[model samples]
Target: MSENELIERIKDRNPNEPEFLQAVEEVISSVSKVLKKHPEYHQLRILERMAEPERLISFRVNWLDDEGNVQVNRGFRVQMNSALGPYKGGLRFHPSVNQSILKFLAFEQIFKNALTGLPLGGGKGGSDFNPKGKSDNEIMRFCQAFMSELFRHIGHFTDVPAGDIGVGSREIGYMFGAYKKLQNDFTGVLTGKGPKWGGSAIRPEATGYGLVYFAENMLKSVDKEIKGKSCIVSGAGNVAQFTLEKLIQLGAKPVTVSDSGGFIYDEDGIDEEKLEHIKHIKNVSRGRISEYTEKYSNAEYTEVNSDDDFNPLWQTKAECVFPCATQNEINEKDAKHLTDNKIILLAEGANMPCTAEAIDVLQESKVLYSPGKASNAGGVGVSGLEMTQNRMGVYWTREEVDEKLKGIMKRIHDDCLETVETYELSDHNYMEAANIHGFLKVAEAMKAQGVV
Candidate 1:
């Protein structure tokens, strides 16, 4: 059967899994070229096996609320692939978490992990448990309940889960504590641990920093530099915060950051002092983005208008933009606005932040677009470092980890370009290059391991 037929079968087998289907179609389209050139891959039926997960575990998380009410949330872990190494990925906690979302994330993780050139596989677990407005005790109890089942499936040398979205260091600590207590062993089964524990130094900042570093490379490919360029960034969470921090350090003028409520635009750029305020508001106080204007009168905060077809944040004039918020944040309309404003580079910090149509717009407009799988692997790459640190029983300093991360991101950027050259594909879209490169490695590994 043809590659397109495989996609249809996938959709039929996993109905209501649009996110997972989207991810599968994107990568399969890239590898389809290889299948057409070398039909052996088709004869071996690699796509059929690669599209399915090794295992999908779903469980019910039961906990008690502060008021003694029984609360339950559905949790899932989709161990998509382990051809390279143990299952390595993050666990998100949000109301939007579902099997489709986790499957897409895990599928993307497979390619993302492959691009990192690290001995890591792909998996993703999360629940529809929203941590918003939950008391500390309640959150801890909920996490303990979630880990009670998750702990059985994960280990240091098996599947190592990290924090994502609503799952932060706090959630990691709670889950780790529960895992330790239940298993009666303290192991590095989880990443994003507090610094006092086994967490690596630069893991929190890695995704954001890595996004900038890769974007910088993309810029250099065209003889451009970011030293004095204006950047518009979306999201004020962990990824967006550190992205702004690194942009400031690199002498770029990043002027915007957003949250669910809306976004803030600061003409003077987000300085160190202003970034500290943002960190405090986001990481500590958990306030809305509009609060940014309260402290700095010069900055402007625009509340989100749900009726609009696009976010005004992308309509701003800038040379570069980072969509660090969530999936599908940049739709086709947003992409057109970006091209109209001459935003040259877009590197995703969040998984699948750009819709397929949006990507078509950016690539057609000559924007240096990089997919999250290739660009945001820094987070998982550092988690691999944390796993190494755990096995070695020694932790590296912040500077040491930062240098290694920069090197890894550089290699990924170079490898993507090299693979594009080898495949002779139109790299106006870097996703095709990254997807093909990542697919080749994992497909070979799976082929080597046989028809298991």
Candidate 2:
């Protein structure tokens, strides 16, 4: 079928799912030329199956709050494409949970997992249940209720879920405990388990570290280097903190870190002592970014009031930018600022943090732009590694897992380069390159396995 025909078919099948359709259309546009090279896939009707997920599971999660009142939230798991291996992705637990967002994430995971060269398929499950302000018992009860149904559809060799957004180690523990009770087995059904359990040592830092590793490859392609470059990173959570740490170790100087409330700028760079304080406060104490400024007089924390500009911290000049925050954090205006400041590298640590308009602006200016699918695949890549260790019943040391993650990131970089060269595209547009590279792998697997 023609491109237009395929798109029309997709629209007819899922008329209201614009979010999922947008992602599918973008991937199709990037590799349409290559698909023309192989008419067999088209003859086999691959696009029909590729456009929709193989399975989508939705259910209700009911729990009792500390007030002895019943609370309910909707849950979902979109097992997109699993021809490569078992379905694997994170489970997010936030108020914003819905079919549109989960479909976008699960669609992205299909390519991200393939890029890791791990035998993991793509899937994502989460609930609209908000854990914030809930007591420990309340959160545990919600997780158990969510997993009671989810456990039936998942397994170690079938589907393995990690954590994302509001779903942290604590939530994973609750879900895993419930799964064990339902299945009556102690299996590695999830990847982001605590170290005391079957979780890998490097899973926490993999995404952030992998991002810098991918960026390093982008730098090398242009005969540039990461050493001594200034970086402005958004988000102080797991992905941001680890990306900053890895960038510093690789000789990049990160000077800014932000949270939901505001960002803190440290001209002297964030030292270990300061990072420890930030982590202790954010992770352990659950305090706001303002506390960091209170303890350290030199650091400046800007209040991100609703009326304030979205990216108040972008006024500062920097050579590199890493937006590790939520979706659409970097707008078109912010893209212009980075370009005006002569930012050489802009790598996304969060999924689609750059709006389509912002991305177009960056592409027009010719700055090296690495999308999150490839740059932030490190977290899921490490989860795949954890699955491997679990299957083998052998846990690796932190250093060993980090080494493997570095290797995978290097390979992802090389794959992007190869795709760019093959298409005669510019090196800066690694987004298209990564998308095509990831797509072809899953496509080939689907072709080999036949339609499910």
Q: TM-score, each model?
A: 0.98, 0.95
Candidate 2's displacement at residue 117, Å, is 0.5
Reference-based lDDT, each prediction:
0.91, 0.86
Which stretches of model 2 miss by more than 4 angstroms?
Answer: 8-18, 305-310
- Count of backbone clashes, every candidate in sequence: 0, 0
Q: Candidate 1, after superposition: displacement of residue 294 in Å?
A: 0.8
What shift in Å separates residue 71 of candidate 2 from its native position after superposition? 0.3
Compare the candidates by TM-score and give the number of the best one.
1
User: Candidate 2 on 227-318: residue-level lDDT in tens?
Assistant: 99999999888898888888878877888988888889888887777788888888887778778888888888887775644477776689
Best by lDDT: 1
**Root-mean-square deviation of each candidate, in angstroms?**
1.1, 1.8
- Which lDDT value does model 2 have at 69? 91
